[model samples]
Target: MRRAFVQAILALFLVEAHPAFAEGPLHVDITQGVASPLLLAIPDISSGAIPEVANGEDAGVALAKVVRADLGSTGFYRFVSVDGHYAAADEVAFAPFARAGAQALVVGRVRLVGNNVLAYDCALYDVFGAHLETSQRILVAAPQWRRAAHKCADMVFAFTTGDPGHFDTRLLVVGQDGERPGLHTRLLSMDYDGANQTVLSQGQELVAMPRYAPGSRKIVFLSFVMLVPQLVLADLDSGQITALKIPPGVPSAPRFSPDGRSIIFSLARDGVADILVIDLQTGGVRQLTNTAGSNTSPGYSPDGAFVVFESDRSGDPQLYVMASDGSGQKRISFGAGAHASPMWSPRGDLIAFTLVENRRLRIGVMKPDGSKERILSDGERDEDPSWAPSGRALMFQRTAAGKALPGVWMTDLSGKLESRINIDPSASEPAWSGRRP
Candidate 1:
């Protein structure tokens, strides 16, 4: 019976999204398996007498590489090597690209605009249809050449997928290094692809669960100072830290509300944990869950109508959902494992969590009512699953059985592709930011 149950669970671990029948732009059916990835061609950017930027390198080539990397990382496109260069405004030869089995082609040109600014003109073409799909001209400071590339890629992604691209977002994570006796933990921020990493906090204090506010530059995290955990708010622009005054309790698993007006977290007192919310403007506290067991990791639904959290009230650490006001509390997870660290998707369609069974940790997602549970990743130790802003992907930490350091990884909703982020100092607990304004 136990073997049958395990087999049943594995059978339903993933459900692919059906391909849309009606479509204008090319949309990759991530829920279904692609027999062949879409073929794309991106030639090296063409330019004339372009001055080098900070690194004294060809800005044109650098921009092209960034664009190519961004598009290729999606797993939907397979680049076809191109030897010839074409200017951004040149007429595309559709016959060669189509004969080469390329469905899409990207061409662009980089030129110096002024003493410190550059202009990037990019164009995308449908090789088979022999027509231009879209084009854009982006102006940026020479130092921000990557941003221009990202914007260009975003244009291509949006035009192709009919969805907003997440290329311009950032990620907030906790960097951990050193041995156990002298471990160091600090707050770190970087691009979504793990570039331009900047330490936001000194290693003097231990920080965890760094969360970014929706549509804001502020991040709220739990910091341990002098062996006491406190909630701190850090401003990315001003580099200021402020301690939030909460009720007399130890706070953990802090997250910003959907509107960013309040914060919901788990507070422990007298060996009992409960969910609590505090108004950011008025600093008023309200207890949401008053249960005997430990209830933590509260995540709000997209509309802020419901919250899902983890608790041991049912004898094991399972998932539970309740009303925003702490009403209608009920268990949602009922599989053969313990579920923890539940986070509601930004689209409010699914809840992502860490599942532990047979002493192996995995990342899983399920419906709000916890009916269609499906494990997305398998690793020796994978925990703290956070959703992408578009709700199509998740970022988590994975540590091998014998490895002491944990690296950050991302997996899409389809569970077809998993890639480790290239960051230093061993990162964990990644919190993906929404699109920046």
Candidate 2:
């Protein structure tokens, strides 16, 4: 289940008038795209041996599985199984798949290199008439073979959609133990595929919602280190800490604006919460939402023009949209549930949030305009979804069955889940960082 989750979150996204998006120029425009899922075939790339065996699961075969996993996880591609297709890239007959409902073919090869390096070659073919789209060669260490496979998938995705791939990014969050006398929350970071797990903050005061600055070595999170619930920034490498707040109110849900110049969050005081933005350069504070109900979870659109947030003004908390300068207020979430935690994906195609359905909490994604709602994680209780820089995977906190303990879980929009780890103390609420660049 965990492996499946990781694969799904590793890929996911399209959509509409996002004020945050600049009208200037698009990084990658996928306005028109093929609805049919891409069809791909990966054969056996046999090596001499594995770390322990001569060959590691047949080079081509293994690489195919990884590519399949990555593409299928996106819910945008339908990879043909090796059981029904020819096993060699050279023998690939595009006629059958293009006729059998496949749009594109992903092919690749891998070779072993002593104990330190592995060489890889990958290609994308327009299976409709068997035309090679593009191809590339990459070199990596033995341990980076899987990563190389992901890169291959990234290349295919970028080539087909004309958008940057997010398979190579990472995610960070707060993890908690299920059983503990007192509150136990810590900061946790891991690769997008659940590799290189590390603890950023031990069970020090509670830490909630950690986000990365654009291409920086620092991470900003809402931490109650002094029990004040202020926005704190921690340098991962140097352990340097910088905090921002006006005293009192818990300045929760800190998120970096698209340009990484400011952070927007909710400042709760006198039992009333409102949206506010902090200027990183001047430490200036400006309020965004001036509604009656408490507004929290303010997220900047990919283009940094609009801010989508949650407000209870209508009696139930629902998704609301407003200009970055706090104008043109409109409600989007009309679903039959109170919606909270609106997160804008870096890709600008979708916004991930937690939806409470049938009295059960689940992680779901929807078009930026609040259409085509799909739940990704529908379980006992799942809330606070944070999207990776790629807008592919979503990291959230889930309580164990019949237990209040919350651990971090990630899933792609298609419902694939990665591994679930039980933290030493109860934990909940997570916000992922944006891409380094």
Q: Which ten residues in a row have the lowest lDDT in candidate 1?
A: 5-14
Estimate, for each residue in 107-149, the C-alpha lDDT of model 1 and write its tens digit: 7787876766777877777787776677777777666567777
RMSD per prediction, one decimal? 9.7, 7.6
Q: Which candidate should be chosen as best, given TM-score against the real structure?
A: 1
- Give the residue spans of candidate 2 off by over 4 A: 1-35, 50-64, 81-105, 111-117, 127-131, 180-183, 215-217, 237-239, 245-248, 366-377, 388-395, 407-437
Model 1, which residues run further than 4 Å from truth? 1-22, 31-36, 48-54, 87-91
Would you give me the overall lDDT of model 1? Answer: 0.80
lDDT, candidates in the order shown: 0.80, 0.67
Candidate 2: tens digits of C-alpha lDDT, residues 1-437:
01122221211111111212222211123353334454555544444354522245665567667677666656556556443533334465666656665556666766655566666677666666566666766566655566667777777766665555666555676666546423676676665555545677766687767788775356788777566677887766556678875545768878888787888888887878999998988888898877676999899898999999999999888898899999998999998888888888888888888887677888888888999887888678888887766666777888766875677776765675454633344445655544432
Q: Kindly give the number of clashing pairs for every candidate.
A: 1, 29
Q: What value of lDDT does candidate 2 attain over all alpha carbons?
A: 0.67
TM-score of each: 0.89, 0.76
Model 1, 314: alpha-carbon shift in Å?
0.2
